[model samples]
Target: VKQIGNTHNREMLPSCWDLTEAVIRHLLNMTDKEFFYWGEYLNEKAKQRQTQYKGPHQVFQENV
Candidate 1:
């Protein structure tokens, strides 16, 4: 929108990460449980792939 100076509500598009981020933020504000749920999901994903990288340093970083 800034590219053309348009001031509309910025139509939500799938490719726009900002839109998804905004929705998650709105939900987080209304319910705190989803906040921890998302963190756990990401943590599980990172943990599952941590060993695939094959580096002690990478594994250590993911543990954090």
Candidate 2:
């Protein structure tokens, strides 16, 4: 896991794991209003990048 994380630019893997858990906990504790706000924010961001985004399979094939 550490090796993969390093390859993916995760300089501080240990801290990343802790932060991930914290984010999960925060998400789980979010009120409905907070959750919906984040959901819409993410949706808007995704839409803005939809044209430039590529799936993992496409990226892998290009690299291969």
What's the C-alpha lDDT at position 62 in model 1? Answer: 60
Clashes of 2: 0
lDDT of prediction 2: 0.79
Task: Quote model 2's TM-score.
Answer: 0.53
Number of the top TM-score candidate: 2
User: Which 10-residue window in model 1 sums to the lowest lDDT?
Assistant: 6-15
Model 2 over residues 1-64: C-alpha lDDT tens digits? 3454346555535577788999999999999999999999998887667547777865675679
Predicted model with the maximum lDDT: 2
In model 1, which regions exceed 4 Å deviation? 1-24, 27-30, 59-64
